[model samples]
Each structure stands twice: as C-alpha cells, then as structure tokens.
Target chain A: MTVLEMRDVVKDYRLRNGLRSTRLRAVDEVSFTLEPGRTVALVGQSGSGKSTIAKLLMQLERPSSGEILVDGEPMPYRGARAAAYRKAVQMVFQDPFGSLNPYHTIGHHLARPVRLHHPAFSRRQVAERVLDLLRRVRLDPDFADRKPHELSGGQRQRVAIARALAPEPAILVADEPVSMLDVSIRLGVLNLLATLQREENLGVLYITHDLATARHFSDEIMVLYQGSVVEHGPADEVILNPQHEYTQLLADAAPAPERRLARHRQPTLAAREGGGQQPLG
Target chain B: METTTQGTTQGSAQSSPQGSTEAAAPSATAERRPVTRKRRLFPPMTLKLGVGLSIAGLIVLFGLIGPLVVGDPSTVRDIGLTGPGHGFLLGTTQTGQDIFAQLAYATRGSLIIGVVVGAITLLLSSFFGLVGAFVGGWVDEAFSLLTNIMLVIPGLPLVIVISSYVPNKSIWLVAAVLAITSWAGSARVLRGFTLSVRSRDYVLAARIGGEKRWRILLVEILPNLIPLLASQVVFAVIFAILGEAGLSFLGLGASGSFTWGTMLYFAQNGLSLRLGAWWWFAPPGLLIALFGAALSLINFSIDEIINPKLRSQTRAERNRWGMSREQRQAAAEVTV
Candidate 1:
C-alpha cells in the first residue's frame, strides 16, 4: 500500500531569448495527496500546468521547490530506492500515437516494465505476463505481436494502460489518457480504466480538460487555473456548487442537457427563423 | 454517457452512430492485419533499388571471383601494350602485365578499402554523433566542437598531408585516413537526428518506466536510426572508394598493392592516353565510375527509407505521363 503526496510543489522553466533570460513558473505551489483506491482528477484547460504536475510526480522533472513524499518518505532521486519508487508509480501519456515506440511490438512495451519490476522471472514467465496484461486490458492476445501503428487510437491507449499496470503499481498517473481517442470510444476506455482502478485498488491521478468525466470518474476534483489550484473538494460538490469563479466557468463550459432544453422552451432566433425545431420533452 | 460526448457538439446523437461505426472498425482492421504482414514479409522492391543492387552485385561478384580464376597480373610477357585479343582478355600493361588480372585484383583491393573505411566511419560517427547528442550538456558541447572542427577541415589536403608523412603507406593506412576525414558530416547528421529523438514522448516514457539511460539509447532510440545509419554507411563506402582512387591517382596511394587507383596511376605513368593503349586505363576507370554510380543509386534508395517524401517524389516521376485511377491505386498498394 502506498500514499503519494505532493506538498507544495512548484516548477519553473528558464526561458532565454537571444541574450535576455526570464523565468516562467509552469507550476506554482500546489499540494495534494493520493490515497490508495481513490481517484483524484486534476481538471484544467491547456497551459494550466496539469501536465507539469504529472511530470513532477513521475519524476521526469524535478520540482523547483517543495517535496513529493511517497508514504511519508521523500522521493528518492537515484539508485535502488528510486527504482522501487518507479515500481510503485506509473503513468499513461496523453497521445497514444506518440506515447508508444513505432519500431517495437506491443509485447515488447509491456514485457519491458514487467521484466524491470520482476527480474527473477524467466523469459517464459515474462511472455506469459505480457499476454495476461493484454487480456486484462480486454484486448485480443494476438495484439501482442502487433506494432503500435497496427492498433487504433483506443486500442493503443488500452495498451498504454496495460503497460502502466504491468508493474502492479500502487498509483497510476493518467495524463489525458482518453482525450486523443475518438469521442465514441472515450467512455469505453474510461470505463475500462475505472474498472482497472477498482480491481487493482490503485490510486489514480486523472488529468483532463473535460469536467464531466472528471466529475463522473474521480472521487475528488482539483481545479487548476494558471498553475494554482483554485478549488479542491468532492467531485459532486465541485460540479454542483463551484466555490471559485474559475471552477464555475469550467462547469459552465460543459454543455448541460437541462440548460439546452430550458433554452429550447424559449424560442431562439435561429429556431424561430428556421421554423423546423424539433419538440423536446 | 453525457460525459463521453462533451468533446463533440452533436450531443446525445453523436455516441450511438459513432459507436456502431467503431464496432466495424475492429473487423476492418482484422482484415488489414494479413495484408500488412504480407507487405512486411516482402517489402515492395523499387526499380532503382533492384537496378542498383544487381549492378553492385555483379561488380562485387566479379571482384571476389575474378582474382581466383585469372592468371598472375605481375607475369611479364614478350607481348606488351596489346589490346583485348589473343588470350589477353583486357589486354597487356606497359610491362606486359595482364590488365584483366590487374583489374580483378584492383577491384578487390578498392572494395576492401571501402568496406574497412565504411566500418570505421560508422563506429566513429555513431560514437561522436549518437552518444554525444543523447548525453547532452558539456559532453555534447565538447563533441559538437570536435565534430565542427573536423567538418571544417579539408579532407583531401588532410589526407595528402598524412600520407606524405608516412614512408610506406599500406591499404589500411589509406583507409584509416579517409575514414577519419569523412566521418564528421555523418556525425553531424546523426547528432541532429539524435537530438530530436531524445526528446520524443516514447523516450521520456522509457525513462519514467525506470529504463536505464544506456538501454533507452540502445533499444528505444537506435532502431529508429538504422535507416539513416545505413544511408550514411553507403555514403561513407562511396567516399572511401573515390578518395582512395584520388589519392592513388596523385601518386600518394598505398604502395605495393593493386587497386583501381594504382592501375590508373601506372597507366597514366606509361602514357596510355598518348600511346592509345585504352585497355590499360579504360577498364579500371570505367569500373570505378560504374561502382560509384551503382552505390549512389543504392544510396538514393536508402535515402527514400529515411525520408518517405523521396519515395513519393519517385512515384510521381514514374506517373508523369498520367496513370489511370486503378493504376495509381495499384501503385499506392504496391508502395504501401
């Protein structure tokens, strides 16, 4: 069991233009805790530093200040402890197309993480584990031999999810896992993720710009605006009664069927001019 | 269900129709698998590649097998400066040496130089280029500086200067000189490519997956660069052969060895041009040019693998007279 905690994390990028150099704060001081078996959705528009937070948690980028603690211990930078840290936490990238290596087969992608985490496993065991992971993601085992290009966007994202699950991670940081997928398949992938999260009891950090899925899929919602968290509460409360103006704006941005139906009750200019508006119940 | 359709403005109607269409997508892809597998098993062999390979193959076979069957090139005979006739297949040199035998041995020697230099260049360039760019910072800066310095230096002058200092230059010595002078350009190319690949999301994912730096560089990055590396190596081989020929023509080539360059050197010394002994010089010169052109054509084909735009350009050129729709589709299928 592991509890991942970000205690006031900040990330700054040094931007240089010719001779002048400026510091851009990509992620301001933000804090959150991810307990096992719970999903925390980091909701924000693009450039709101949601990905920076994910990167910082993945240890791809070091925090400018503050510390990320894993189960009360500060994150290790290198050596055995760091490797163990990697085994506990895994990520699914946004772009399924860009996240996978084109030259490698899907089996290679899954087998690598399994092999890394379980060095004692024989070659046969590793191969078996790879096939098992594919099945767990509801994919045909034949997909193990196929390269990433052979798979559709939804299928590739499923493979990415399986890869994150291969190491049997305690926490999964999914960075816009389904955004690049087609709209029709998004729910299927998300439901797959929610099912996996429940089965594995893995703490999840679901990062996205979509507020509805954030509310539906996550237990808690943390609205990030300009690298800072403006609102953080239970998912329903955040959606139902947004405390921050930014959170209200985000909630308003998502189309509400009720709101549309109410608008339809009062005839709109286009509806009046077109004179062909369908009646709504 | 409401959450899923948020990306699209179509609202509730979007999901069902798209969902039905997506169900067919999997079966469609299942049918495509065997075709892709077949394509992979037998990649479409382009005309340029076939022509180049055949020409190169014939030349290589001649070089390898010719020396074994031919008589001694050094054997002196009474009949000197003869043309292609009377059992002398290519003719006689100024000293009655068998020009055919000399050409055989010379082709073999030049090929050996090209292969050796090519191997050396591949090692040196990949080290300085791929390694440096993958491991950036001061190391990259230092390597880039060294590569830039090497790139700026004139190859022929440097080779000439190095060759002049050595009293008895062997074939290996000439090959080494050419390799050292020629690798910088390929190194720069590899470095630029490595820089771009290093930052790709897959590489980052590998790093986050706890992959060691060396493994990431080797397994993740190296395979993608294979086509580029092959193109560079072919270019290197061409350069080595041509550079060795130039050095030998200038009377600074490997001594006591038979190469196309040495054959040309001896022919030039004997005034084969003035004496109209075309057999003495023409075969070796023509062989050098043919070999270079064949390798270049092969290089262009390899370049198409690295930059797919070149493949499309060639296809467009092939269909310049205007192909029918079915013909174009067939062409596309073949290429695909």
Candidate 2:
C-alpha cells in the first residue's frame, strides 16, 4: 500500500530586486509514491530539486502547487494538522555536522522527541528507550551524556538516525544521509537505516546524488534532472541498464575501484581484468 | 577536563611544526587544574575586575557594620571639616557631607539602577527579537518598523524630555525609560541572527520532533545565541550605566543623589574646573571609565575564547611562548 504520495508537487522561491522580483521554480510538478516498508531513492545532481522534494515531504517547505498526501489524505499546511504531519514524517538532513543541535547532549536530543511523541512512556521508560535507540544505531549508551561536538562524524550521523526514529515515523525522509560520512563507515549506516526501515515498516525516501549508494540502499530509484524525473525503475535495472543520457553519465561517474586505481595507476590494465562496474558485488 | 587538556596538549605536541611544545606544555598543564581554580581567580567577568562588583562588595561589607567605624553620611559638620589631617579620609563636600560615607551610600543606588536596567533591557530585547524572528510575517514587519522608528529617535534627548514630563519618577522608572530606548537596536540584530539560526536543519528537526514555538526558541535557538546574547548583555549594562550617568549628569536622575553623574552635575555648577578642583570630578569620572572598560575587556575576552579563529590568532600575555602565525599556517597546511 502507498503510505505517502506526492501528486505534482511544485515549489517556487521568490528572488527580490529593488523594485522588482523573479520567481524561480525549485521543484517542478514532481510526483512520486512511497510504499510501506520500502525505500525510494530520488537520485539527482545538485540543483535538481531533490532536497526540496524531501523538505516538501517533511513539510519543512510548503509546495507552491499540488497535493502531498499520507494515506490518501491531503496534508494541511498549518496548525494541528501540520503538527500531526510533523509527528508522522521525520527527516534526516544532509550535513551531519549541522544536523544535530550542538549545545544539547545526545540524550537530551533523543529524550525530548520520545517523551513528546510517546507521552505514555514514563521517565525510566524514556531513559531505557533512549538507551535502546543509541544501541540500535551501534553507539554506546554512555555516549548519550556527551554533546554533539564530543562525537565523531559517523557517531553524529547515527545520533541523527536515532533522533529521527524516536518519533516512530511512518515516512523517514533521509536527505543525502551518508554523503557526508567517510566511505568506510557509509555502508554500515546505510545498512542500519535499511534494517530500521524493515523492522519499523518505514516508507523511506532516500535522496542522494551518489548512484552507487542509491543502488545499494534503495529498492526503487527515481532519476531527477532539472526539476523533473527523467528516468526511474527498480534500483538494479535503473542503475545497470540506465535508460536516459543523464543516468548514463551519472553511472559512468560512479567512483569504482578500477577508476580510482587508474587515476594514479593504469585503467587499461585494470579494465582488462573487469573494471569495478558491479556495485552490488 | 583532564582528557580535553590531554587532547589539546597532544594536539599541540603532535601538530607542533614550530617546536613550541616546550612552552605550550606547561600552560596546558596549568589550564587543566580543573576550570574551578581558574574560575576562582577569574569568576567569568564581574567577579575579577568589576569596579562595581568590588565597590558593591566593599559597601555591603561596610554598610552593615559601617556605622561602627564611621558616622552617618548625612550628618553635617560646621567647622574643622576642611583638611585630610582630620578624621575624614576624602575630606568633606561643600554641604559638609563626608565624601567617603556619601560615596558608599550612593553606590547602593547606582548598583540597583545598573542591575535593574541591564536585566530589563536584556529580557525585553531578547523577547522582542525572538518573537519577531520566529513568528515572522506581519508580526516581523510590525516589529521591524517599530524598532527602526525607535532606533532613529535621539535616545538621550527623548529620555530628557520624558523624564522632565514625568515629575517624581523613581530610579527604576528612569531605568525603564533607558531600557525601552536601548532595546531597539539589539532586537533588530538579534532578530536577524535568530532568523538565520531558525532556518537551520536542526531547527527543522526540532520542529518535526513536535517542539512548540517557545521550546524551539528557548531550547534550540537561545542556547546557540548565548555567546552573542551574553556579549550583548554586557554591552547593555555598560550602556545602561553610562546612560544612567548621563541622565544624572543632566540632573534628570535621582535628585541631589551622590551618584557619579550627580557628582559631576553638582561639581560643574559648584567647583570651578579652572580652580583645579579635579579632586571632585576626577574620581567619579574615573570610576565610570573603569566600569565601562572592565565590562568591555571581559566581553572581548569571552569573544576571543568562544571564537576559535580569534583564539588561534590571539596570544595570551601570561603565556606568550607559542608558534608564530607563519609556522602555524605551515603546520595546518601539512595537516590538510
């Protein structure tokens, strides 16, 4: 069943002059459906409005046109309805550095959400729940007492995930979550997110520019270009047999081992022994 | 504390391309003696160099047990109240009031005005700014216009006109007027800053976490604005003190009060500056400068500490044994 649906979501931002103004279309008639317990990766280059779409889903930015519905009901833009939507739809931002509040401890960051979203949880229950969340993200429970500055980049990203999950959101919009992470730790975070998605039956909208990570993390891939989806399908099919020119260019740009080794070493020698084309392998 | 000191020491040592670890190590060791010891010597700001803090402390120490050592401030003397050879330390004023006693009693008023005015300004400006920034719409437009209008009006002249009209206004009432005048500029600046911070992703995360507007403003926005807001409060206090002095100097503050400003006002009318009665004017004038400078120094020091770029650039006077900029720059380049 489709849990979240965007029907022609269009967003425009106004640019000001001294006496005149211009409207720039950030998201142009973008439409997509997110199914239950599934992952949809919105793949786009910078300026492709993928992040705008994610914000629209989270209702951080309102759509200029069209409907955003959860369970076939159009979401309201303000007051109690907006509040309800906010509780249901959680977001993980791009810059892991700026995603968490710097002044607050990790436990303060997690507890507020759990207590607000799940009021039935007692003080001890909240404490236990926060610890469980920390553990689920592969962080030490003791680390909760520490501030965001005390944690490493990977650890901060995990805390962000834990905070997002505290609300037990139906739709989790992760905007380039692992892009800011080190390549070695990126897969682990991705795997954790995937695990949480299945266990919680979350409809995850994973937005990224990295086609390779998209293939690894997402079930269905939507290739957005210049504020519109040019190509989309099952992740493997879309990535392996890219139908559009932009998708082909993106697939060619994926940082494979052979190309990385070839930049300093030789591509011809490595290509002969099969270049790092298969990301799943 | 130990770990952070250890980390900083290690970082200084590991990254020391200029070979200044010999000097930086001891200072790092000195810094690690728990922030409490450092705080004991330098209690944030006012605890160390605040003339007001010291004067207030001294006055409190003396006031309760002061009468035992000295006579009442208001007590008049007819003769032999002229010279320093007598019992009076600061000698007597033209009205036969003891200079030292009057100074101590007057401090109570000044301190009260400073605290009352400073706190009022801080709370008012922060509220106005936070609301304007967070609510943002017609509310922002209305506040922006109001603050800008208030900013353009001559503050001192307005205070003079208003205080003159409202006869028998208390020191607290004068403070309220000053507070009302001073908050406009701070509100505008804080509003701009809060607007920027409110747009950050974490703020959105907090909103999505089901935080109310007040909680988001207090918990999310206010915490980040502390370093900025703290500096602002210090500025507000200095301004309030100076403004209070200015008003009193113009005879608009507490009437016939022995405040530093009132001292200046009375001295200007009474003592001929040409006659070298610098004794009357110089001390209080110097005290005003002292209060302003002390707050300014603490604010600048805090700015330096909180700001990493500034901290890196500034060398401590006590511990000047550090690598030069060229050396540090070379070291950072190597790291990159």
Q: Report per-candidate DockQ.
A: 0.60, 0.69
Candidate 1 structure lDDT: 0.92
- Per-candidate TM vs. native? 0.90, 0.84
> DockQ for the candidate 2 complex?
0.69
Best by DockQ: 2
TM-score of candidate 2 on Cα atoms, chains taken together = 0.84
Output the lDDT of residue A91, model 2.
Answer: 86
- Candidate 2 TM-score restricted to chain A: 0.89
- Kindly list the per-residue Cα lDDT of model 2 for residues B74-133, writing each as its tens digit: 777773235433677766656666766665555555666777777887887888888888
Across residues A1-281, which tens digit of lDDT does each residue of candidate 2 receive? Answer: 33788999889999998879999898888888998788999999999999889877776788889998878898877888777777778888888888788888899999999999778989999999999999889899988877787688899999999999898778899999988899999998899999999888998999999888899888999999989889979999998889899998898888677656545465565566685543321
Question: Model 1, stretches more than 4 Å misplaced?
Answer: A267-281, B1-43, B315-336
Best by lDDT: 1
